[model samples]
Target chain A: MVERALLLCLLLIGFWGVVAKKNIIKKIFGLNILNAAAVMLFILEGNRIGSEAPILESGLAQVVDPIPQALMLTAIVIGVCVTALALALAVHLYQITGSFDIETIRERIQDET
Target chain B: MGKRKAWSPTLQACLAIGAMGVVLLPVFLSQTPWPTVARDYLMQYGQDESGARNLVSAIYLGYRAFDTLGETIVLLVAVIGTMGLLSRVESLVNTVGDDDNTIQTVSAFSLRGDKRSSHVLRTHLLEVVTGKIGPIVLLFGFYVMLYGHLSPGGGFQGGVIIASGIVFLALGNQQDNTSALSKSSILGGIESVSFLLFIIVAMSGIFFGKGFFGNPLADSAYPVGFIVLLNSIIGLKVGASIGFMCIAMMGGHD
Candidate 1:
């Protein structure tokens, strides 16, 4: 229950970051935090009673679910890719506009028109 | 200062909070547990069937190889997109030269101001340390990749490790002279070849009478070899692709 609450709190914080922040970099970081929270939630859900690592060891009875871990591994890599792409786009945006502030960029665009 | 707001910040925050609450309500209320049928089957026969003692490896390389292939493609697409975008800026800078001051300022920011004096003792120490540790980190990455089936680490982890080592080397080297280590073309070549090899191996399984990406060696006593091969290929592909991406992205900055 505590873990679930913590995960939810993290998700909410990330949501706040994404919604409230104007800086593009902060938005990217919020996206990352959101990804991390989801990954952790999946891993946490896979935890079982008397569960052990999925490695085949002698006389081991219960092993935690490996499927989630495998899927989450893919998710983590995809997250990295997304972060990289977003940062590259941010760099391009920064190049076009002198500032990272979204409002400033918007005003600059309007003035140009 | 009196611009009309699309929606008040409080209203947006309340909407966000409400949406989050609605989304999480079901998860908090019900405890529909994960089905154990697949997990049980995997735990029982995973080793004998997939020849990987680590069940996660079996799932990743054997049962779900198709998913892994798709994931690699996703990574490839992302790298290509980033490089394409960055290359446009490079060409723009090259064509414009110093005519536009704004472009000059943009390029300067993008370059990250690595204009440090080379004779600085602190810079020399950093260079020496990164130069020494780089090879060791790379070797360790290979070890993790090769031993993935038996250990916790896998191609993705090892590949990231290797890329970080390359990044360290790239960062330590002076900006004016390109480092011997930062060969983007060579890294790109390795990435393409390894991805092709991975696909070829996957296709070979189909031709060998095993289903697509099926373990042809499952009939043999040591089916782990196939998993190991896939792991190595994945490691090389990921490491090269990430390393190339890093080099390409930083290439402009330097």
Candidate 2:
């Protein structure tokens, strides 16, 4: 129960950080936090009520749903890629301009307009 | 006046908290018990089909290996894109003179100004946290990836953990050189090796005359070990790909 709540908090914090932060780099940090929290939540959710065995089982028994765990794995990899791409864009944006702040970048872009 | 000015921050805080409460409510409220039907279906059919007791591995390596492959490709594309967009080769050459100027500014400014005190304070705090907490997180990530076959984590989960650790390193040490540790060649090599290993493992069944990506000799004693091996391979691919992608983007930047 406590673990679940912690995971929930992580999810929320990550979301909050991404949405609220203005600095592009800080926004990336929030996205990472959010991704980490979501991945942790999926792993924790896959936990058997009392058994430590992964969703894998060899014999005739009810194992945990490995599907979500598997899906989450893909999700984690994709998340990392997305974050990297976003950060790379941020760096490029920084280079073309000279600031990590999103508002400044936006204004500089607008000025070109 | 101070209190009056606090409302903006307070309002921001309130909106943040409220948004969180709303996002979390549905996830918490809608709970479903693990279905007994799934448990039985997997136990009976998965062992015979995948020839592994661990149903999760069967699903991971067998059922959804395609998804894994797609994710790996996503990472590969990300690195390539980052390299194209953010490679420091041009910047390094073009800004060599500017780099020296900034370095001089940083060093000189540090020595004789009030900024030095704050810089020293920040450096000390960074050293303290990165030195202490960083290794623990890295180790935990390794354990998560390694023991994924037996626990809740697998290659994907563990890979992200490891990538996060690398990100932590980048965060603490903003020096461009620190990021170079995850070089393109090194990361590219690890990513390819692991990916190839996965293909070989999956094709083992085809070579052995079983079904496609199926293990004929899986039942006696070695199938379990093979599954575990494949899990580790997947972990390596996912972890290295993610680590490489993250490092490439940041490391190659000016």
Candidate 3:
């Protein structure tokens, strides 16, 4: 129960970081944090009361849901691609305008327009 | 000033409603027993399709190979689009020629200036492991792709695992090997090979009177293994394509 609450709290913190971070690079890092928190929450949620192995065997004990674990693997891959792309975009944007700050970039774009 | 005054009341109302929606969503979600529903569904229909003990892998690769294909396309498209956007063929090469620019800048220098670093990792253990274990993992990922039909893994997972191995080189040997490693022609070769292989697999159904992307080889003797084989092919394509894409983007970026 306490673990569940802590997971939720960390998820919220991750969300806050994505929303509140000023630097575009930091925002990408925040997004990665948020993704990690979501994956952790999923794994935590799928835990059985006393499941033994994710690999289903015949007669030992209850097994946890391997679905979320498998899905989370997909999610992790997609997350990596997303983070890489975001960071790439950030790097390119910085190269263009010479600023990592989101507000500064927005202002520069506005000036250009 | 007029726009600010005009938007204030509407914005306040939207914020209040949005906050309420966020608060109420979890409350509504908690009342349902979704996991039990999923489990019961899996127990009924998941086993035969997925040969492995892990039912999740079965659903992902077996029951939902179509969706996985679509997901692979998304990653592929992202890599291609990034390459189109960032391939600074002329200026990037010129930038790489500078000797003074190679120093690692730990502080905020001029924003317009690009810094190149030839800093090697000080850790001896990392050098040994990355040199040895990295290529082995990449080769193993291909094995995972080939054997996904009989085992607990598939193409997407194996492909990403292989990409992770490639990332080690990028981090370890973070020099201007981008152009040398990520040649556009090489990426084209990898992409076309996978795309052609996928089309051939799908078209085999037409030639052999099986359904689209159907296993012509599967019969009562060992019907399911062919689908797993298809999964592996898809996995190999996706994994190699992504690995090459990441290297290409990293290499091309100035």
Candidate 4:
């Protein structure tokens, strides 16, 4: 329960970073943080049922749920892909506007028109 | 100023945080117990069914293989999008470099020195270390990828490691004998070829009447062979795509 509380705080922190940060790079960091929190939360929840890792060996006790771990694998991969795409977009924006700040970029774009 | 800053940024942050908390409170507070049905069933027959000692591997590479296919497709698309945007940025930079006044020109830097210790670019010592360690990391990545059925690591983990190795190789390209794997064209070719091979293997299961992504070797003594093959294919695809993206991001324009 305490762990879940901590993860919620982490989620909120990441959300705040995304919402409040003016820099596009910082926003990408926030997204990665948010993704990390969600992944950790899912793995934690899935771990509630057992004490062992999902790898099977002879005479081993009950293992934790592999389903959530498996699902989280996909989530983590997608998160990486999303982060790469986001960073690429950020770089492109920087090249275009010569600024990392979202507000500055927007203002510059507006001026270009 | 249009509105004289009517609402403070802090107030807006507070509102967003409060709304987010309201939305997520239920999820964090939920007391519903984790179900055990699937876990129990997987424990009982996962090894026998998939020939994988690792149940996680069994689930992803066995039951939910189509999902893995989709994940790979997503990775491919992300790489494609990144490379596309990157090429545009490259061309933009090149056009800017047409003017002699632009100090950011690639040619301008190369003419400065044989060992370019640019503001944030590589150092000689770092290059040497990364170049030495890169191939070993790649070897370990293949090891983990091949033995994933019985171990903790899998295609995704090993593939990420392999990407790091490729990044290392690219970073250490000041030396001879390092240009081959770091070449964007070769990396792109590897990614495309592996994706094709993945589809071919996936379709091979159909000819064996094992349905889509079904283990064609299920009846054989090496049912886990299918998992191993899939892991390698996935590892190659992931590593190549990510490596290509990283190389491009590092301004390996070719």
Candidate 2 structure quality by residue, lDDT tens digits, A17-110: 7777778888898898888887777666555432435454335243456666667767766776788788778767877767788889889998
Give per-residue CA lDDT, model 4, range B1-254, as digits (tens): 69575788888998999999999988986889999999999999999999999899999999999899999999999999998887887644444534434455332222223534452345678778887889999999998899999999889888988999988886665534446777888899999999999999998889999988989999999999999999999999889988888877767656
What lDDT does each candidate get? 0.79, 0.64, 0.60, 0.86
Q: Candidate 1 chain B: minimum summed lDDT over ten consecutive residues — where?
A: B101-110
Give the alpha carbon lDDT tens digit for every residue of A1-113 in model 4.
89889999999999999999999989999999999999998898888899899999888777899999999999999999999999889888978888889889989999999
Find the candidate with the highest lDDT and give its number. 4
Docking class of 1: medium
TM-score-sorted candidate list, best first: 4, 1, 3, 2
Model 4 error, position B54 (Å) = 0.9
TM-score of each: 0.88, 0.65, 0.74, 0.92
Q: Give me the candidate number with maximum TM-score.
A: 4
TM-score of model 2 (CA atoms): 0.65
Which portions of model 2 show Cα errors greater than 4 Å? Answer: A1-9, A40-51, A55-64, B1-24, B43-55, B88-183, B200-212, B216-221, B225-229, B246-254
Q: Model 3, B1-254: lDDT tens per residue?
A: 25554655446545654574477347433534436556556655555534545565566655555655666666767666666655632243333334544642211111121333322222445545654676777788777766664455667767767765765544333323432223456655666677677667766766767666555654446655655666666666666667666665545333
The candidate, 1 or 3, that scores higher on DockQ is 1
Model 4 regions lying over 4 Å from their true place: B1-5, B91-120
**DockQ per candidate, 2 decimals:** 0.59, 0.45, 0.32, 0.74
> What is the interface root-mean-square deviation of candidate 2?
3.5
User: In model 1, which runs have C-alpha deviations exceeding 4 angstroms?
Assistant: B1-6, B91-125, B174-180, B252-254
